[model samples]
Target: MSEAASIAEMPPRYDPNGVEERWYLKWEQDGRFKPDLESEAEPFVITIPPPNVTGELHLGHALTYGIEDILGRYTRMRGFNTLILPGTDHAGIATQNVVEKQLAKEGVSRYDLGREAFVERAWLWKEKYAENIRQQFRALGCAFDWSRERFTMDPQYVDAVLEFFIRLFEEGKIYRGWRVINWCPRCQSAISDIEVDDREREDSLYYLRYPLKDGSGDIVVATVRPETILGDVAVAVNPRDDRFRDLVGKTAILPLLGRELSIVADEMVDTEFGTGAVKITPAHDFADFEVAERHHLDMPIAIGPDARITEVGGPYEGQTVSEARVSVLRDLGAGGYL
Candidate 1:
């Protein structure tokens, strides 16, 4: 309708669509793509990297599957019993996110539907999109065995997955442990490191005045994220820096939260950076988390999964990150610690 050239008709002074319609579909339907199991021809098998049933296939899918299709065609022509096995992955988080967004538009959430009902909606979503994806594979005129197409959540595939996990468990290969992870506040889920997108932005650095428990004049440290001060376990200075060398063993009181923060000297601290000292909020910042581990200090969480200030933040508890930042700065300014 938009006058975009159909891929089938995209060729030099000729139409591949006619050839494709008369041959590719019949060649595929006649089982020309499927390798003969009984034949002694040298087997050339390649299992597809399953695509998620999220939506229509994109250019990424075209690039990958196109290469495989070429290889499959070449092998079959060379008298090899080529088997290009095709399948779809559940792609768990991505699929759930799609369904949740749909439910959101209807003024409901997965919680309202409950686990069983939510899963039902997910299946319905999968069934709809998975069929479209399968059809797209055929529309591309690839020599794939549609009859043998599999879904990751199919009973047989599920059984195979469970068996593999059970074997790993029996060998004591999997265990639970405390560690830092990337959490999506919007999704309320933990995602892999690959899912996080890093961005560069300019920000103002705030100089926070931390009071000494001994009633001595305050020591100042600089930070870009003043909100995480509620979780501060320690303040670190460069061990080689002469400025705060004497104050290394002293205790500094966190301004708003009143948490006792030990002043520690570490080589990781950048002496040339702001104020030659940095606050260590282990639960909120990765660098601070590492510093805490080296000092054998407790890692108290300042924020919850919803990116809201937790109970440990005291007066700022339940406030969103932005809201808490304003409140924390306001209180800090009132107390003359900003």
Candidate 2:
């Protein structure tokens, strides 16, 4: 075999173990990662999307870094000064969840520890995880400017967020109101609309009977949730429904409370639903609010802030909606109201 062929045919013994570490250390130590404004090299800047410091390297991060590293290396080979900035997010919700879990193990709470001490503890946790992530990124051999790392909750970024809020407020675009915001029960915070993920849910479809005023007949209605019955403001059907056409102007006697509620016709009703009637529970459901508004109906709030039946629910008050549903239904059936 030719000399070149013989060398090529030799058992391949290329081990990246030593060279990878050695090269990284040399590049970092020699300040090759730092930006040089004096040099007239064309710049190719690309920043990796910051991951939460509280998270670990999953399949998603691996894929992201692989693409970024390929681009950075290609640009570098083309003789451009490539700057692939690397960083992590403080991710207040995620980081806090970690620390809170740790505190829970010690039978302590963040509030009990006080803000200063809790923040200190959080900083300690951040330092540990941030170091781990930094080491992992280094292991990946990403040509990132490690010297210029940024965190989302860094003082500089915090200033930016504060400035943004102030500017929006000054423009009269940021106002606070008692609105139903998307709340994260686990995170105990109001999640931004952009952060939410819509999910499919399999819910119960319940049959409920709303009694008539003269104690004669009961109107049976189907609901995805029997729990919301306490909040029922009005019963509605399609205006074109011949069955309920005469009942449109009548009043419905609420199952448990004997409260008189109006019967209204609206286009929002799905004609295929049981009895072709939908109970309007404005305080509990958003769709009901619009229907109530259109009909000029009185909205009696039945669900409290704590998600339990309110004081206005009388006998069913203080109980959870689920528990109250059974009690209310039983009473209605016993009274021959259903």
Candidate 3:
């Protein structure tokens, strides 16, 4: 056999492990991954969903990167000026949690380090994780424009975000007010609704009796969150329900707080649900907030950001939601209101 044919026929081995680094280094060095802005080729762009700079890539990340790489390669072959811009997210709350856990190992809190020092530590963490992610992407043969790599916390990005916020404020689209929001007590930050995970778990249902202002019998309300009962401004019942139709327009005395709550009729109440009555705690529950708005009722905040009962909770103040639940349930049983 000829020398070249003999060498080629000896063995056929596909070894990406050996050649990947060399090709990636050459491609980056030659700037082949960068889009030719001056080229007349039709622009084809794909940006990666910037992964959090708090951890290494997982299987899901690998799958997404592979799909994007395929698209980038296909577009490039089709005579298009393809650009795959790579970036990492600061992942504010998530990255903070990581650094906080590291600090916890030394029996220290972020407060001990102060804001500036804590932020410095977080940037260091981001650098480490971000590099790790880049290395993983390179190993996967992802053709990304490293020249245009960005971070969410970059100065330019921060300025852009501030500009957007100011624009919304000027447009009267942004306003700050006390509203029921998903809160993470551990992180001590208000999280968006999308960050919340909904799941079914076994929880206790507390059946409490609210005495009528009139010499009539008490009305029962079954709730899983008795800790919020202290914030109740009204007792809501379905207007169509014959059982509570006459009870409407009267007042109910809140058991523990002794607060007078109007017995209001709202079509929003689910009569088929437990007790056919619902307690309106506008400050704690979103549905209750809407009812409060409609009825022009007060919104009493009974829980603070720490997930502890606030001063509005009276004697239960300073107790965590779980702790207050036990106390409230015990008191209800003692008073024969359960």
Candidate 4:
């Protein structure tokens, strides 16, 4: 029998421990993983979804790399010039938080280290964690071109990002404005919606009475967050709701702040929910922020980035959200507004 036929008929014995590394190293040394750009062969190119340089790889990384490696190897065997590029992401806030925790261990903050020193420290942290990820990829037998490895924070990448942003700004595609954003108090940065994790949690709902300015009567508005009452700028109700139809053009007195709040009719209010009335605290709540913008209402920020009540919170200023909730509820109950 031919040698190839004999090898094909051999018993199947899976032993990756010694075999994988040896074959992978040989493949690298033989330059089989490198693709010739000028070649006429069908090209199969893939760039890894760069893993964060903030930490070591986990089970998720293993699974992802395994699937991609299978594709790369399959394409190479099919006579395609496969090029799999490997890279690591700076992960911005994630990497910053990791370095910040390290700094905290030594009783120092990033601000204390200064910008230049902090950047230097962050790069060192990236280098350390990046190598760990590279090894994990190799263990998974990923046939990536290590010579083409890249980092999101590299000088070329940084320049490209800057150019993109500058082009957008010049074209009027980018502009700064006061907008509601998902903020992380710990990271002290704004994060995108996808970064937020949604989970079920038990919470308290508070109902407060807002007295009408014309002495007609009071409207009860229910809220899960009473601490935000300090930022109340308007009281909204569905225009189609008969209960609040007559009070649309009137004004209401904000319970705690004693500020005059217009009783506005906005379609955004759900007539079937919570007494059909909602207090609009534009700066704190996203829905309220949109309603306030539509009606041209003022936005008062009662909470700061630290999750503490701000100066606009009146007597509750400087108190954390939880603490202020207790104080606000206590005062509301005493004043017969609860």
Q: Which whole-number lDDT from 0 to 100 does residue 40 have in model 4?
A: 93
Clashing pairs in 3: none
lDDT score of residue 239 within candidate 1: 89
Q: Check candidate 4 and list the clashing pairs.
A: none
Model 4: residues with Cα > 4 Å off, grouped in runs = 1-13, 40-44, 70-82, 99-122, 191-199
Error of 4 at 258 (Å): 2.4
lDDT for each residue of candidate 3 in 1-338, tens digit (9 for 90 to 100): 78999988765878787788998999999998999989999999997999998799999999998999999999999999999999999887878888999999989999999999999999899999999999999999899999999899899888999999999999999998767888899788987676678999998887889999886988999899987898999999999999999899999999988999999999999999899999999998899999999999999889898889899999999999989988998998898999
Ranking by TM-score: 3, 4, 1, 2
lDDT of 1: 0.88
Residues 1-338 of candidate 2 have per-residue lDDT tens digits of: 79999998876897777789899989888977666767689998887898887767777887899899889888878888778888888877768888999999999999899999999999998888888888888888877889889888789878988999999999999897334356664566766665678899997666777877866676778887766777788899999888888788788888767778888999999889776989988766778888888888777777665657887888788887678877776776686644
lDDT of 1 by residue, 1-338 (tens): 34575755667576766776678778877899888989999999889999888778999999999999999999999999998989888888888988999999999999999999999999999999988888788878778887788899899989998999999989999866556789998778888775678899999899999999999878899998989898889999998999898898999999977889999988889988999999998888888888988998888888999999899899899999999899989998999999
How close is each model in CA RMSD to the real structure?
6.0, 5.1, 2.8, 4.1
The C-alpha TM-scores of every prediction are 0.78, 0.70, 0.87, 0.82
Report the candidate with higher lDDT, 3 versus 4: 3
Clashing residue pair totals per candidate (backbone < 3 A): 0, 0, 0, 0
In order, what lDDT does every prediction score? 0.88, 0.81, 0.92, 0.91
In Å, residue 315's CA in model 3 sits off its true spot by 3.2
Which 10 successive residues of model 2 have the least lDDT summed? Answer: 177-186
Better structure of 1 and 2 per TM-score: 1
Ranking by lDDT: 3, 4, 1, 2
